[model samples]
Target chain A: MDRGTRITFLAMVALLVAAPYVLYPVFLMKVLCFALFACAFNLLVGYVGLLSFGHAAFFGSAGYVTAYTVKMWGLPPELGILLGAVTGAALGLVIGWLAIRRQGIYFAMITLALSQIVFFYAVQAPWTGGEDGIQSVPRGHLFGVVDLQRPLGMYYTVLALFLAGFLLVYRIIHSPFGQVLKAIRENEPRTVSLGYETDRYKLLAFVLSAMLAGVAGGTKSLVFQLASLTDVQWQMSGEVVLMTLVGGLGTIFGPVVGAAVIVTMQNYLAEFGSWVTIIQGFIFVVCVLTFRRGIVGEIMGRFGPKGAAPTGGGH
Target chain B: MFELLGIPPQALFGQLLIGLINGAFYAMLSLGLAVIFGLLNIINFTHGAQYMMGAFVAYLSLTHLGLAYWWALLLAPIAVGLFGILLERTMLHRLYKLDHLYGLLLTFGLALIVEGFFRNQYGSSGLPYSIPAELRGGYNLGFMFLPTYRAWVVVASVIVCFGTWFVIERTKLGAYLRAATENPTLVQAFGVNVPRMVTLTYGFGVALAAFAGVMAAPIYQVSPLMGANLIIVVFAVVVIGGMGSILGAIVTGFGLGVIEGLTKVFYPEASNTVIFVIMAIVLTIKPAGLFGRAT
Candidate 1:
């Protein structure tokens, strides 16, 4: 990593480690979970240039799976999370398989449509508890050892998970595979002419992104101790998009900052009811029209060397 | 008197009519989307919110302004269309040179603003819009009873949809539109004002959605949340039909609505999701959609 990025990363970690002592651990954990989710989403949109509007399917379905397995099946929290991630990857496989057949706007619409099916299923399925959702999920012991029921314990565990997911995303972006993904994003026809199976690469990136988003959702359900329809709603999908856009579309740290900003805003604006939606929508308009570089991207462009900034993933 | 597959004809026909009514809305909405996408190349994510606005305008005018349904039918589209023109001019026009996704995101944000504003003004609960006196009762056909309003919706939407299709497919204005879609610079060089055309096309599409919403206000609850879910279904219809053909969009919208209704009759559990399932099946077999050319 570059010197600036490394220092920024260390500072972020240090602040996160110390954050729970001052702020509510539950709220911080929520930010971390969303940060992870946004990072995963960035893998597709930022690097591969594939925008899947249906990411809530992976995130929420994973939440449901984690909730169900931990609460009903009596599985430990770790196992439940693993199962949730697996479910996410499985869903990504199916959704990505179908969605990659089309590109651009149609791809977004297809994913949205498919995810709506998941939303409907969640609504009707007997296990999801319909409107109430799978509630009162047990946090469960971490591998029969650590007591995650404690606030600090849960906070640290979530932080650890977030870091791991964050590093994995960083690694994926720098890898040869990631280069191919970027190449495809920049010019799919050229990448295909270079003998890369662009679809396979795109599909793999999608699955990985979905899997990480699942991890975030799974962790979130445990933190909240409930899995509800709110997680699976199309609005949830849009929220993540807003988070990613506001922070910075392609930057590694952008989604983290974005998630933190959005989550914090929601926390503060909880009392305002639908005004939050209006403000968020306003931000979306402003961002698309004027602030496409986003907070992190703009910062990087100003301070970093010429031509080195991500600048909203090359577009 | 007879039963088809052990189901009473009354029940079956009633559901079919309901499905057709739904299909009519779908046809109109998707037709609007297809038209907008064809020229603008941006999926109007705010299309749903615009639809909801149409219903709201219709409802509010009745209660607040004492404007009746007929006036709402006239004014709502004009009001919503003007709003769409404003959006296109101020916001959407700036994004024509960028990736189309920005347009989607911008519109999505606009949708949130509009939906949120309405939700703030009127709570999530639906406001009632009574059927007009001219179309309140039902027609007792030989096999079943069809609500007059519902029948009128089908007839109105069909006429509107075909009228749109005919104008686009056969008229001089449509020829210019088609040429512009293929090559805007060339069309512009041919002395046609293309930007004005784009703005009007967007306005017209938004107007069509409002028209559907107004038509739907009485039949369905004029709720803020109504268009949100319906828009997603229409998106599925768009995918299944593909954006290639205007007629395709109309047919797929209506066809899927009927199929959804059939699913409701046969398997009630799958009714809400039958269209999405069809989308999956269509993507598997024909990714370009039934009517879309492979891009």
Candidate 2:
């Protein structure tokens, strides 16, 4: 990573480490899980120019699988989360294969449709326990070493998971493969002319993104000891999109900040009930209409390394 | 009792009729969406919310103004259409030069605002819109019983769909519309009011959805949450139809509605998801859509 990026990231990490001491650790844990979720989403929209509207499928399903395994199969927490990540990868493989056939707006619609199919399955498939969901999921001991029953143990574990996912996304975005993905995003026809299999790159990026989303989802359920329809709902998918947009679509750490802002809003706005939807919708309109660069993206433009693109993929 | 394919004919035909009535709404809404997308190049993500508004207007007019159902049918579309025009002029028109996705995002937010506010006011529970006295009864054709209102819905929707098709495909005004959609600058040079047409096209498209909502008020509860639930399915119908052709949108919307109804008859659990399954298959085979002209 560049000096600018590294410094900013370490500073953010320090803030997160110190955050729980002052704020409720549970709420902070929720923010960290969603930050990881949005970062994975940014990996696709920011770099690859592919918008997958059904990401909640990966995030929610991984949560479900992890919750089911730990609570029902009696597996260790780490293994359950690993299995959740695998499920997300498998779902990505199938969804990406179909969704990549279309591009732009149609691509968004296809992902949304496929995710609805997943939502219906979650609603009907009895193993999910229907509307009640797999509740009271035991966080169990982390890797059979640290007892996660303590809020601090759970909080640090979530922070570690978020950092791992964030760093992995950073690594991928700077890799040669990420370069090819960006090339395709800028000019697909030229990328093809360069003899690159653009579709393969897209599919691989989609899989990686989905796996990370799954990791976040699985860890989230463990944190709350519950997995419900709320996670898999289309609104959750939209929430991720909003988080990504508010943070800055293409910049590193933009989605993390966006997720933090949104999660905190939900916590504060809980008493307003459905007013939250209106407020969120208002944010969507304002952001799309004017502030598409988002908070983090703007910060990067003014202070970070020069030559950063003014707007990231699919403004 | 006579059976068709081991299921009772009465149940099968009843479901099919329900499917056909649903198909009518799908046809009308998708047709409007097709028209808007063809000209504006942006999906009207708020189509559902506007539809719910149509129903809400009907209910509100009834409760507050003591306007009868017939009066609501006449007035709701105009009210909703005017609101749509206001939105088009102020907001949607701004995004014409940006990425089409921005338009989608903006409309989606507007929809959430509309639906959420209505839900807050009405508490998500449906308020009833009674069938007009003239259309309150049913007709039995020996094989199955049909509600008079439902039969009228099919007939009225068919008339509306055909009327719109004739106007767009055959009329002088439609000629101008077609030309404007193809080349607005040239149409403007020829002294045609292209911008007005664009705004009207958006309003008209939204009006079509509202009209369907008016028609649906009697059969379905006028609920805040109804449109959001229904519009996603309409989106699936639009995908299967493709945005390239007007007729394709009409035919596919009705076709899928019937197919969904049939799924209800055969595999009850899959009814909700059957259209989406078909959409996936169509995407794999013909990503542009079954009827849409390829770019």
Candidate 3:
């Protein structure tokens, strides 16, 4: 790794390691889960240039799956989280298969419509418990060893999962497949002429992104011990988009930063209720109009190499 | 008293009428979306919020100013259309050169702002919007009783939809719009004010949504969330019909509404999701949509 990236990584790890002692573990865990979710969302939107607006389907459904398995089927937390990730991948496969048929705005809309189907199912399905959701879910023991019920144990477990997901995303972005995805994003018609199946690349990126988002959602349910309609709502989908957009679309560290800022804001402004929506919308407007590079992107542009900063992947 | 497929005609026709009424709203909204998308090249994500605003405007006018339904029908669209024009001039016009996705994001943000403000002020519950005296009550058609307001909504929307189609397909002004959609630079080269046209088209499209909202005020609860829910369904309609042809939007909107209504009769549980299911099926078979040419 470059000296700058190495230093940033070390600093981030250090901060995270020390965070639980300084701040509330539960809140920190929430930020980490969302950070991972944003990173996963960034994988497709930033690298592949495909914005799947229905990502909440993967994230929320995974939460439901993990909650149900751990609570109802008496599975371990690790196994529950794995089931959640698998559910996300399966959903991603079905949704991605349909969404990849179109590009750009249509892709966003299709994913959104399909996700709404998932939302309705969650609302009506017997297992989901409808409006109340799967509440008071037991976090259960981690691999029959670690006591996840302990605050520190749970925090460390969540931290480990976040770091693993973050590294996985970093690896994907640097891989040969990631390069081809970027090539497709930069010029799909050219990529097609070069004989690469652009659709396949897009779909694969989508599934990976969804799987990771599921991981985040699953981890989040364990942290809170609840899987509610809020996670699956269209608003949650919009929240992740806001987080990714605010952090920086293409940069690896951007979504992490974005997620922290947004989750923190939500924590502080929890009592303001609907004003949060307005403020978030205001941020969205400002970001699209003036701050499209996002917080991390702007910082990187000032300090990092020229032309290294990722564009918004415009078509 | 006759039954079709073991169901009474009244039940089937009742659902069908409800579907047709819903189809009217869909046709109007999707038509607006198609028009704006054709010219502006951005999905107006705030279209739903604007529809909600239309309902609110009508409701507020009646409650505060003592104005009636007819006045709201006349004033709501104009007010909402002017707001839309202002939005286009100040904010939306800036994103024309960037990716279309930015436009969607901006509008989505705007939608949140608008919906949030209204929700903060009025809360999420339904606000009453009584039908006009002229349009109250129902017609006994032997088979099923049709509320006069409901029948009027369908007729009014049909007239407006056809009128928009006529203008776009047959008129001189529409020729310029069609030309602009094809090549804005060429249209500008021909000395037509394409930017003004773009702004006005957005306003007009938003106005169409408002018009639907005003028509919808009495039949449905004039609630802040009404548009938020309907817009997704309309998006699916846009996907199934493809935004290539104006008529396709109208046809698909009404057709899907009818189909959804039929689902309610045969299988009530699927009524909410049947449109999305159709969208999935359509994508698998014809990715470009029913009327859209593959781009």
Candidate 4:
């Protein structure tokens, strides 16, 4: 990462830290969680070159687990989030194993189908509380020290998690394994011929992505103090896709920008009701047709690939 | 008068009839998807929207033009097919050289637009489209009353599916189409206008969806949201059936529909998701789908 990128990221983080004092902390928290969700989804599609249409399985499942643990079993907030992450990892392993068998469109279809099953399970399973979901989840204490009932305190906690997750993703992307993933993305057969077990790497990446997505979902449920049916819907899956696509798939920090824009848009557009879906659809069409590189990608392209290690992959 | 496994035979056969009716729609729709995928190498995500359009068009024809069910059935596909043809000729034709996923994404966007627009105009609630007077009644088949319209839908879809199979598997035109799919450049050298053929193929495939929509209008409410969810299920069906063979799509569509219907009778809660459950199991055992060859 360059000085400019680093400085910009820090500024963004600072803004997020101060936002709760100025703006609504709960709303900001929602955006942060969604941004993290979008970022994790971006890791798979943008970096690993796998487009999964069923990420809600992880996101929603984690939310349910977090809610259940906190509300029913009386787990602390941090542990509830951890439980959610584990749920995501477990699902990712099974789904990744099955999905990696197919390539391209078929892989997408498999993920979608698997997630649909998860959706159905959530609907019927009594633990999910059916349509009612787990409501009024206690935020509890973080690390048994920081009181999370205060909006500002909760906001900082989420911001800390976001920053940690974001930094870890950045480190992963710059690491050696990340390079291999890029290779696999650019050309899988050639990578396989080069003696790398591409599927294993892909599966691992899938699991990590799922776990992070789960963290986001889990965090969001805590912030709202509820885990509901909306999280697992196919529409939620589509929303993540739209965010990543609009922000520029594969670009670092793009999902954050994309998620922020979308969340804000949805927040303001909520009053318009179904028109929100209509407008989002319009954005998808426009982005696919004219701006496939996305907002960050387009700007990054204008500056050239400067101050970065070359891995031979271009947008 | 008879009972099987303590369940009345009439209820059992009635469900079977409903299963067949559903299977007919599935067969027609999946056949369309398979045909489009074969030629264009693109999943037509807008297919469901076009199916919805077909129903809406038929409804419009009946309400506005005072057209009968038979005439609406004949006209709706043509109208929707022409719309699809225009779409292919314009936007979709440009993405032929790029990645196939772009086609899927573009069509998905188009689906959103179509479905959204309909929702805006017509609202989410379905409009009732009654069965034609000619086919309004039922047949007493000893065990159950099978609606004539339902039976007609099944027979018509069977004929359409099989006729498409025959034309594609055993005809001169089909040979050209297949050859083009294999190698468009080589087929072009043989004096075939491959691009035009692709456009027509897309139109034909979309028309098949519209045809199914017309058949479905009376059975289900003619609503804009009707096709949106069904298309995803059909995608699962296509994956499971392996889009590799026309016959595979037909058989799988019908089979899964019957399985779903049976699940509804035995375990009502699972009926909504049994097809997806079956898809997951299929993926675990046969990654390329039941009939799909490894790409």
- Model 1 in CAPRI terms: which quality? medium
Which 10 consecutive positions of candidate 4 chain B have the poorest summed lDDT?
B96-105
Q: Considering only chain B, report the TM-score of model 3.
A: 0.99
- What is candidate 3's DockQ? 0.81
- Candidate 4 stretches greater than 4 Å from native: A306-315
Descending-DockQ candidate ranking: 3, 1, 2, 4
lDDT score for residue B52 of model 2: 89
RMSD of 3: 0.8
How high is each candidate's TM-score? 0.99, 0.98, 0.99, 0.96
Against the correct fold, how does model 4 do in TM-score?
0.96
Give, for candidate 3 chain B, the lowest lDDT window spanning 10 residues: B1-10
What's the count of clashing pairs in each model shown?
Answer: 0, 0, 0, 0
lDDT of 4 by residue, A49-165 (tens): 888889999999999999899989999999999999999999999989989998877777778878888898999998998889989999999989889998878989999999988
Q: What are the runs in model 1 whose C-alpha is more than 4 Å off?
A: A313-315
True contacts kept of 2: 0.65
| Candidates in order: C-alpha RMSD to true structure | 1.0, 1.4, 0.8, 2.1
Using DockQ as the measure, the top candidate is 3
